[model samples]
Target: MKPAPFDYHSPRTPEEAVGLLAELGEDAKAIAGGQSLVPMLALRLAVFEHLVDLGRVSGLRGIERRGDAVWVGASTTQTAILRSPDLAAAVPLLTRATPLIGHFQIRNRGTVGGSLAHADPAAEYPAVALALDARLEALSPRGARTLPAAGFFTGMWTTGLAEDEILTGVSFPVRGERSGHAVEEFARRGGDFAIAGAAVAVDLDGAGLIRRCGIALFGVGATPLRASAAEASVLGVKAADVDAAELGATALAEPASVPSDLHASGDYRRHIGAIMVTRAWRRALREALDA
Candidate 1:
């Protein structure tokens, strides 16, 4: 199927894009890379009267370090982020998860902002963004306001974005001396959507004990979830002493209730989610110790 007829606008600047969005209101769609939105358009799942393409936008497509955080422009491609020396050095978990998103072709065309706006629970970036405690910068007719990662996702395929808002960029803290990141997932095929996945980041004390740990799960709930129970299990424990098996069990002990899809049963998702969590946690712990 082809997309429904729509007016298209290529905005060279964010100000122009914001103005277009304000003019077009809810009928307008902001597209970058179009990896996600194009598919929606082709399927007619999204019916927009106006398509505001941001590929030409000058300020929304780069990576830079500001103060203590690494700021990624919303339009930055997954491929670009995966290869970024600054991102890898500052937030390796994003690098770890980027390759898991899809094939190289998809990564080359998928924008970080696009993925976040799409808000697919199974996508790799959202969980990493949440685990890293990233801040989303969005522009609107009302002016710009930052949204915390925790408050970004409202539900499946949904976000807090107002009709006239466009995500400008995201900012996240750089990894510290004893910090590490990890991601693990399983799929029927290499490039397929994950049945379940986990991204973990751990900060250790000089004594190698977990000072802080964040475990985020994907494809096991309506939206990607932070595994507070699993994180709590590892806190105060030395990395070497962490019982991964127990941690896995703990994550699945009262697994989140999720709707069963034909691709995988609810129980299977819970099981796989637990395994992914454990793997990510273990790898993060090792990385933290090595730091």
Candidate 2:
């Protein structure tokens, strides 16, 4: 079925988009790539009386290095991320994860902000954002406010974005020297959504000891989850000696947190999650040590 009949408004600027959302209130939905929302609308899983299109909003589309972090406009497409040399150099994890997203056709039209705002636990971008401590920027009638990645995702297909707020951009910090990042996931097919995945970043000290670590898991929880227990356990330890298998187990230590579905049992998903985490951890460790 087609989406419910709705009035469409194309906004050329972010201010106009925010104003439209504010005025339209509960009935309005802001759309960029529409890769996720359109399918939901088509299935009648979501309905909005008014659609605010941000395709013409130029302000929310670009990539640049601002100070020590990389600022990616909310409208930046996954295709753009794959093609940006600077982004790859500054945040290699993003490029490494891009291929694991849907096929090139979907990536061509899928915006980073759309994926994050939709907040599907199985998506790659959200987990990568979490692993990198990305900061999300939003605009509202109340002005601008930044949300940390840790708190940005609230639940399945939900986020901290208010009804009247529009996500403007995101900031991913560059940890600079001695840092390595890797992404590993299990999927039924090349472009299918991951059944379980892990994005890992490791920072090593001069003596090859772990300085910091970030591990984010997807497809095993309502929202993308950070492997805090595993992260804390490996800190300050010799990077090479940290057992990837044990680290993976620690990441999924809370078996109850993993969800079961027709595709895979919770126990099975947790087991796959552990393997993904282990592979990612080992790759990240190698890169960090070599750096």
Candidate 3:
């Protein structure tokens, strides 16, 4: 298969990229890593009259700290995130989850913003973003705006980004020394999309009680599912006394929400979702205790 014929524009800056996007309107698509979009193009799943390449957009690539949050340019590669000591120290959940994205080769070419924009339900980045309460920055001809991770993902392979907008970067809050993180996922192979995955971050008080917790599950719903109910159930509880099974059950209380696909049944996905959540929660609790 081959991509449909299209005009290609290589932009040197984000403004230019967005400008091209705005000018092209619904006929154009902005590409960063092209890991996901390229396949879509080849299969004709997505077609456009123009392709706006942002690879040369310098402003859209880097990792830096702003106030209490770390801003990662949309073009930052998964491999870069995996090797960034600053990112690992500031947001360990991201570091823990990056390797599970695909294979080493895939991660080498996959961009953070590309994954977020692609919004794959089984993707590690989306669940990590939701768990960390990250913010996505979008640029358009109308100007710029920030979107909370919670509302950014609207459905499977879908997002709130307007057709004329380009994701420029993402911001993640710095986790303090008292916080711990872990990622748990189940996949058939090393690079396969997760059947069920969970990303967890926990902050502990001096007394070893869970002061705060963030839990996000992927491959279980239309979008990354934040287990607020499960998180609430463990607050003020001793980390050592937390119940994985109970928390897992709480996270998937509505079994109907789990999707049934060729890989697994709804009941099985719900079960796997619970198991992943439990493992992530317990591992995070241990890290918090050790911290």
Q: List the residue pairs that clash in candidate 3.
A: none
* Per-residue alpha-carbon lDDT of candidate 3 for residues 196-283, written as tens digits (9 for 90 to 100): 9899999999888889999999999989988888889889998878888889889878435788899998789888888998898888
Identify the leading candidate in terms of TM-score: 2
Q: Tell me model 1's lDDT, rounded to 2 decimals.
A: 0.88
Worst lDDT window (10 residues) for model 1?
250-259
lDDT of 1 by residue, 1-291 (tens): 999999999989888899999998888888888988898899998899999998889889889999999999999999999999988999898888998887999999999999998999989889998898899999987888999998798899899998778899999889999998899999999989899988889999988888898888888887888877778877898888988878877876555496589999988998888888788878887887888
Ranking by lDDT: 2, 3, 1
**Error at 189, model 1, angstroms:** 0.6
Residue 71 CA error for candidate 2 (Å)?
Answer: 0.4
Residue 246 local lDDT, model 1? 80
**Winner by TM-score between candidate 3 and candidate 2:** 2
lDDT of candidate 2 over 1-291, digit per residue (tens): 999999999988888888999999999999889999999999999999999998889789999999999999999999999999999999999889998988999999999999999999999999999999999999998899999999899999999999989889999987669999999999989998899999999888888888889999999999999989889999999877899999999998854568888889888999999999999999988888777
Alpha-carbon shift of residue 101 in model 2 (angstroms): 0.9
- TM-score per candidate, chains pooled: 0.96, 0.98, 0.97
Candidate 1 TM-score to native: 0.96
* Per-candidate clash tally: 0, 0, 0
For all candidates in order, the CA lDDT equals: 0.88, 0.92, 0.90
